[model samples]
Target: MYIDGALTDGQGRIDVINPATEDSVATVAAAGFADVERALAAARDAFPGWAATPIAERQRWMRRLRDEVIANEDDLRACVHHEMGKPWAQTEEDWDRVVASLDFYAEEIARLQDFSLPDRAGTHSHRMVWEPAGVAVAFLAWNFPLLNLAFKLGPAMAAGCPIIIRPSNETPISAYAIGELCAGIGLPRGVVQVLATETYAAADALSASTIPAVLTMIGSTETGKHVIRTGATSIKKYAMELGGNAPVLVFDDADLDLAADVVCGVKFSNAGQICVSPNRVYVQRSVLQAFTDRAVARARAARVGFDRDDDITTGPLINARAFDRIKGLVDRAVAEGATLLAGGDRPQGMNRGHFLAPTVLGDVTETMDVYRDETFGPIVSIIPFDTEDDLLRQANDCGQGGLTAYVFTRDLARAEGYAAALRYGEVQINGVKYDIDLPHGGIGYAGVGHDCSYLALHDYLVLKRITRARDTTLFESVNA
Candidate 1:
């Protein structure tokens, strides 16, 4: 972990294993209780000066950090690839997001100026000002660590909040890589640091320390709950992007080929580890079989491998635990009478790492485990529905609020109706889109807070109201 512009050991160390090969890649030092406190203390020490920095200077640093990440893109890409088994191309896209975020926030800082409120009378005035919330911490999930870091880091820094990021032990190297980049840009010591904690005990202790006035995290819903429950003592504000069972609706009139190709491609991308990957596919009963056939063909044709082979469409799961967890979902779904239309086993002839075939389960029901829970792997549950009302009920019945809904329909009315009715943070009709401009966050259990937009900076800002009494002379005269 990088703390105060230096690399130091903490409680102990852990081996970062290559998920694809299940071989040790690196040994990363962990931040113990004392070390975490020192890191937090350093951030606290640096916060006032950094918060006082003019926005232009802050933006200059942001741009420099962005450029540093871009220049070291290859090294970062290799770290992400080796750490998480993501294909090189996918890692490149992640780095693209890293650069895009810095550029986006650096440009946006000048636009978020402090302002004064209207005065009620000539004697009284009110001014509204935004100030940094001191220190902040972001807990990252391993799947897209770099992108998630950008999600929190850019906005927090842009808002003038010093940050301490705790990367997932599963993929900790990339966080160190980012910390080193910030150091290269000559960011004030402790303004940005990475806490590579090896144990849940250490991470929980650090987050619960009350030093960080603002907290942000991107991870599973259960994990988010734990963060909230444990970190409640400080009463610090939180921004979280938790678990998602992204639902896709394929209306009967939709183009079957386009819908099938995109749905299958997305569900299997990154082995379906993406929080917003379309998980439940509800097809109109009339075209269910046709769509299922097309989707099954797409799934069956997907290749799983170790590298970015032109033929590969999916990669290995993060680790053995992920592989087994997803495998159990498939097995239980099958045992409960769901038809395995395409894949339910490992790819043939190769069996070493955490690889699973792209799978499609047909005739799935709302009662199945696969339907009720997040698989978080290369699997999709397809259920046929005849009525729009029934489909809507099924779509909206997710236990939690963190969902992304997709609608594929040619009719304008149908599209608009579904768009308005879907209970998810983001809705995509006909095409998929995510960028720095749109606000992305969960509504209910998906967790609090948002990412990527100017709104993100609001999370790190503390609003202050300044009131001026200009008519003091009238009161003084009356008193005399």
Candidate 2:
């Protein structure tokens, strides 16, 4: 753990284990308020000089940090495999996201330096300048720990703000390793720190700080709301990338095979623990049967096993808690009129790990439990829609508007209409690659639009309009 430019011991420690094999990976110190205060004070003290540093110099350190990540790619891959239980094959892509995030910050730093503000026609001259806030308190979940961390930390660093991160206890090794690399890159002693803990002690203290500015959190919708309320005292800026139930819309004109293939890839990528993973899939009636059959076959073909095992498509849920929630959701959905098309049981022969068989359900309705909630697992619900208009209506019907709807269609007009009507922050059309540069947040219950766009850099920085009179003498005479 790090506090005030140094490593400090916490009151308690917790052991990190691989959920797949129950092997002891590492241990991290779980700190309290005292530790958080030290880090806060250091960040507060360093804020001015950091924000004052020239943009070129700041960008230099950011690029170095990126190089450090590239250097340690292998180490990061192995750590992610053991701690997160993601397939070994996926680790490389995960690492690429981290690198891409750093690269994004590098470009942003240059753009920030060159960006000019709109000038008022006459009178006083003005320039828009972005300045860093004091300290950012970042909390990461277990899934895609590094990838999610990069989304916040990259901009925070580019804006010259110090950050204090609390990675999930279940999957902290890769984050810990990345922290070490960041330190090696020399991000100003206290620029970026990580506290791997069991409880939310560090976050609690950081939220309650007296510092005028703080950016709090990355977690569930409930947790994000809690942080917002607690941070009201300091009136800190809140940047939350909370929970999402991203919907996948398969229209009648869609390529069934393509939709089925992409759906499986999206859902099972992180064992379906991703907040943005497709949770509720709505397929048009014309291709519903063929799509369901193909989806079921593809889901069944996914190789499920230990994370370390080669050629595995998916792994166990983060822990027993997630497994329980997923199981409960599946059970209740089946009871509420959803029929299991292919899988709905625990994976056979995996008695030791938290393994779940990839499940697909048919005849699902909007009223079903699975359709109404975000199931962070391999279980997917397929609902049939009669028309594209109806599909769009139902897709955006939920009170929770947090979604990244996937529309598969060759018809440009249909795709354009859905894209215009769909209320998600990001929409994937016909095998589009997910670009990190694009904005990737949600509306309503999903989140408050945090970290999907190039404009996200503004979240970590405050703008000032500096002004100068055309004539100092005239201004002085009027003021005096």
Candidate 3:
């Protein structure tokens, strides 16, 4: 752990255990309030110099970090795989995405350059300069550990702000690797810190202090709400990427084969642990039987186990709590008369790990608990909708709004209509994928903040508007 510009040990250490083998992977210092205080002091001390660093110089460091990340691709992949049990392919893809985002910031660095607005009706021109908010506390979730960090840290680095990152207890190796890489590239002293711990002492301390100018977190909605309440007193700038209950719609005319394949990948990837994974599938009644049959077959064909050897479709749930929640949802849905189309039981072979079979449910009604809650596992519920309006209502009825809705329709007009009707951050038409340049977020309960593209940049920045008189002499004449 890096505290007060020094690498120091905490009062105690926490063992990071692999959920797959139930073995200790590594031990990390579980920092105390004292350690947190020291980190905050370092952040406060480093702020002025970091904020004053040239944006160009900051951009250069980010570029170097980006190159380092790409060069050490295999190392990152291995870490994410064993730590989070994520598939090797997905981990590599995540590394690619991180590099792409860094490239995006580097290519768009000019946006941070101070500029003078064209004089329209004023003798004095308007000026705009992007300033570092100060210190930023990045709270990362266990899933997609490094990817979430990139979302917060990339922009902060570009803006020349120091960063303190708290990686989740479940997965911290890759994040720690990132920290070490940054240090090797010589991130200014106190500019960035990464700590792995069971207790959120580091983050809690930063939230309660004045050193953190901005706080960015990626976690559950519950956690996001907690941060909001705690960070209220300090009145620091905050950004969040919380949980999501995304939905996939298969219209009557959709190609069942294509829809089944794409949706299988999206819903079960990362063991259905992703915030944007499509949790609920609405199949039009006209093709419901065919769709369910194909989807179930595809799912059954999906391999389940460790990501290391089996290029499996799914892996273990993050922990016992995640598995319990998933099982609870399944129980609730079955009691409410929902049919288990496939995969209701746990895998027969696995007994030690927190593994869950890829599950698919049918005859699921909107009133059922499975339809109303986010399972956050390799569990998906299928509901049948009769009409366009009905499906739209079913999709948008949940309190959570940070959903990613998908519509599979060959008809362009139908696709357009469904896309327009869904209240989500990003809607995919005919099973298309999300582009990094697109604005992503949800309406209502999904999330309050947006990520990706220039729209995301707005959250990390504050704009200042200056107005001036066309002529100073004219203003004096008016007074005279």
Candidate 4:
């Protein structure tokens, strides 16, 4: 972990295992309570100075970090693959997004600089200024470690807030690599610190501590709730991107092929571990079989193996725990009478690694656990709806407020209606595209706060309005 702009080691070491081989990739030390304390203290002490730094200079430092990320892109991608088992292409895409986010902060900070407001009637003037929300604590999940870090880091830097990051224990190598890059770039001391704890205790300390004015996390909804409760002690602001059980809605008039192309692409990505991956697929009765057939075909075509094949789209699950859990869900869904249209068991010639067949199920009901739960695996269940209204109702029945939704229809009127009716944060009209300029987050069970776009900077900033009266007005205090 990088603490106060210096390199440091933890008390004890933990083994990082490769999901594909179960082999020890590297040993990382646990950044214990003392490390957490010092990191938080350094961030707290440097907040005033860092936040007061001129925006232009801050941007300069930010660009340097961005340059470092771009320069060491290969190393960063390799770290993610070795530690977390993500495929090479997906890791590359993640870095591309990371680079874009860094560029975004540099570009967006300029527009956020104007803070002056003229007097209403020439008697008073106001200076509407934005101050960085003091020391920020970010909880980075393992699935997309570096990309998730960029989600919080870029905005915080642009907002002039010093930050402390708690990376997931399962994927700490990339976090350490990022720290090395930050240290080498010569960032101001304490502006960025990465905690290398072996457990969640470090995150607990940072969240419950009174130093940080803002706390952001990317994890499950249950975890988000815990952070909310703990952070309330200090009245800390929050930005959380939790779980999702995304549902894809296809109408009778929808283009079946287009819907198939989009759903299959997203459902199979990252071995279906994405937070907003399409899980509960709701298709109209008219095109249900056609969509299901296409999905199953795509699943069979997707390559899964014990080794990293650039040709292989599916990587092994994080570990044995994920493997068993996903298998259980798939098995139970089948037992509950959901038709296992495609894959229902482990692949042939894959007994050593945590590998499962890219699965698809049809004739499912909302009552099934597979439909209601966030199936963070390479499996998708298709539920056909008898009517348009019926399908909309079932989609709304999602308890997690799935973050992303999809609708494929030739009729613009029908698409508009469905888009407005969906409860999720983003509704893709006909396909999938993750753009940095767009805002991403969720509602209901998905949690709250904005994580992308210009709104991300707002999450790390506080607005203050100061006014001066040239002469005493009607409502002005006459005693002063």
Quick one: best TM-score, which candidate? Answer: 1
lDDT of 1 by residue, 397-426 (tens): 887585688899899899999889888888
TM accuracy, model 3: 0.92
Model 4 residue runs over 4 Å out of place are 113-122, 306-308, 472-480
Task: Tell me how far the alpha carbon of residue 438 in candidate 1 is from the true structure, in angstroms, after superposition.
Answer: 1.8
Each model's TM-score? 0.96, 0.93, 0.92, 0.95
Ten residues in a row with the worst lDDT in model 3? 196-205
Compose the digit string of candidate 4's lDDT tens values, residues 166-239: 88888888888888888998888999998767667666888989999999989998899888887877888889
When 1 and 3 are scored with lDDT, the better candidate is 1
lDDT of 3 by residue, 1-480 (tens): 765545667876877776766677787776677777777777778888877877677778778989999999999888888887776777876677678777776556557556678886556768786666778887889888777777766666666677888888888788878877877777778787877654665556667676787887887888888877777777688777777777898988898899888788777788888888777899989999999998889778878777566477787788778788888899888998999887876788788877878888999887887887777888778888887766777787667565677889899988898788787877887766664566666665556666667566656666665756667788898899
Q: Could you arrange the candidates by lDDT from highest to lowest?
A: 1, 4, 2, 3
lDDT of 2 by residue, 1-480 (tens): 766555657877879888777678778777676776677788788788877888788778888878888988889888888886778887777687778877888677668653345557766677777678667778787788787778877887788887887888887777777777766666687788887654675566677676737665567888888777777777677777777777888877788888888888878777888777888888878888999999899888988886455678888887878788888878887888788876676777788667778889898887777887878899878988876556667788756666577888789988888889888767889764666788767777667746745777877887777877667799789899
**How high is the lDDT of residue 14 in model 2?**
79
TM-score of 2: 0.93
lDDT of 2: 0.77
- Against the unseen true structure, what C-alpha lDDT does each candidate score? 0.86, 0.77, 0.77, 0.84
